[model samples]
Target: MSETPHEYPGQLIEQVRTAAAARTPLRITGGNTKAFCDEPTRGEALSTTGWAGIVSHEPSELVVTVRAGTPLAELETVLAGQGQCLPFEPPHFASGGTVGGMVAAGLAGPARASVGTVRDYVLGARFINGRGELLTFGGQVMKNVAGYDVSRALAGSRGQLGVITEVSLKVLPFAPAEATLVFELGQHDALEQLHRWGGQPLPINASCWVKDDTQASAPNLLFLRLRGAVAAVEAAGERMLREAGGTRMDNAQAGPDWALCRDQRLPFFNAPSADLCLWRLSVPQTAPVLNLPWAQLIEWHGAQRWLWAPASAAREIRAAASAVNGHATLFRAGADGAPDLARFDAPSPAIATITQRLRAEFDPSQIFGQPA
Candidate 1:
């Protein structure tokens, strides 16, 4: 490969072609903000940051096509200027987080429970498979389609299947009004309220409930953010405050507070001890609050839960999640001599077989990360 800067897709294609010819594994990297999320990979680094730029954006059409390496903050800023945004509200774990990493990580912010996830907004993508073949999937719009939508499949593939070169995403107009409310409630009460509101036409856009470890007698604070038409937001805010006994929190505090939760920078995430492991549980939205021997922070209305517990509790945690028809992942672990626990849950036999087939089809040489 030439040492000269290669900033275009054609150059990236040729680079991959050479790597494929040499049977050399290429580790896809973008802003490198999410490298801690996955296990350390073995391969030559193929930095995608060099190929960054917005390819095409039609705000009038509510679609934007951007290179995979484009920084997520830049993309969001551009959309904000146009009064449009990516409804998924992908989190930027770091200042340099990239669009490719966002999709690969497959994480969404508070609004996920209401609007949808990162994969749902994915309209199309162009990527280079293990064989160095460039392929395009789906399109810019959500038109009727048949068969599989490969673009969405690649959203959370984590560079195991291919190197995403460019992506086209569906955007939404900014809400006309927004408000945040804070309720002093217990875990059970907060969970019940979230579930009840889920069945209604409430304009709730995001929520977070966390216990205050500092004050043993202090009640858990439940933060609810409502967004939509001005009238709807006002109406919902009034109803929630009157019925739920919540006070209207300053809107100014919403952005930074949400950012902390989204990026795992909240005080709850700060480990009291280096040996403690951070676990993420994905259960049904209506699943009852877990009775565990660890502190918990509830997000995504109720589907996403975070637990700060010792690494030894991995089995028990996983079992508890399984009981609720959910899965648990070791979101973060210490480098100290911790036992090796599966980062993700084991798939069912049918899913395992299909995953293997997909890996075989996209990366026959096993040049990417471990299959499935």
Candidate 2:
């Protein structure tokens, strides 16, 4: 909240040092908005909320360096003021979401498929390793070929490797034009159309297909967003409407709808029953309709799928995802709280070896809590 930056690198280092000497695991926390994201780890809390503020912003360079604990909303507001934004459109999840949590979670919104992932925009980062030593990687530039790009790896480490202290991110200017189109298409038809448009030079940015139980006449629909230069957007919008047979939604209505989809506030995201958990499937966009028996909301042009089903169905769900060369994550547990299932799929043998090596190098004593 303070205009000036609030940093405590010394205090953070000292705490880590003391914990390392005792071989104590530390759970790095920021805002705690995404605590439910991964398996909860037990350890002494290392709160990063106190280490907050924007370190620098170079609108000309399209980069911003900020302390890890700076509020996500505040960062977005600053970028909006400059007519720029984090192209990935990271999700806040809740009010207290912080920059550190955003990078750590590495979950992107609908536009992710078009722009990139959180790791793509992460230019650089600084963190405190298990040895209690502060280390920095990458820089505030688009290209840095000096050393290994370990900075981008911190994007989705989930605090397992170290406690992220600060980060430099690449931002992009807002699109000069934007438009949303709605089509009354079923899941299969919608995906077919998206794949077709994807092959062309269309300015398609984001797409969401869901069954609107509230609308009896047209329950199945696909909401597509296009953003780019004025001419491109206009041309794409007209072509899609004429050839695709859909109506253009007013910006005023579409804007909030997209936001809701980004933050999982849409009705489709709501759990119909307390026993059902939220599952996220990351598959190839061309993957066909899954035969799973559950309500689904497809996004990212069919790459990301959200479903609600009991945790007991984990085996079937995970198998279904794997068949399409994808992975399934138990994004959120049921109302009863954390389930016995793993939050993420187990890494393959090769990836597991690399992950273990990285953890050993950065966190030799395993002082950082491991998310399952």
TM-score of each: 0.95, 0.97
lDDT of 2 at 92: 76
lDDT of 1 by residue, 107-139 (tens): 888889999998898888888888878898878
Runs of candidate 2 exceeding 4 Å displacement: 1-7, 214-218
| Worst ten in a row by lDDT for model 2 | 1-10
For model 1, the run of ten residues with the poorest summed lDDT: 1-10
Error of 1 at 231 (Å): 0.7
Among the numbered candidates, top lDDT falls to 2
Runs with alpha carbons beyond 4 Å of true place in candidate 1? 1-7, 144-148, 337-339, 370-372
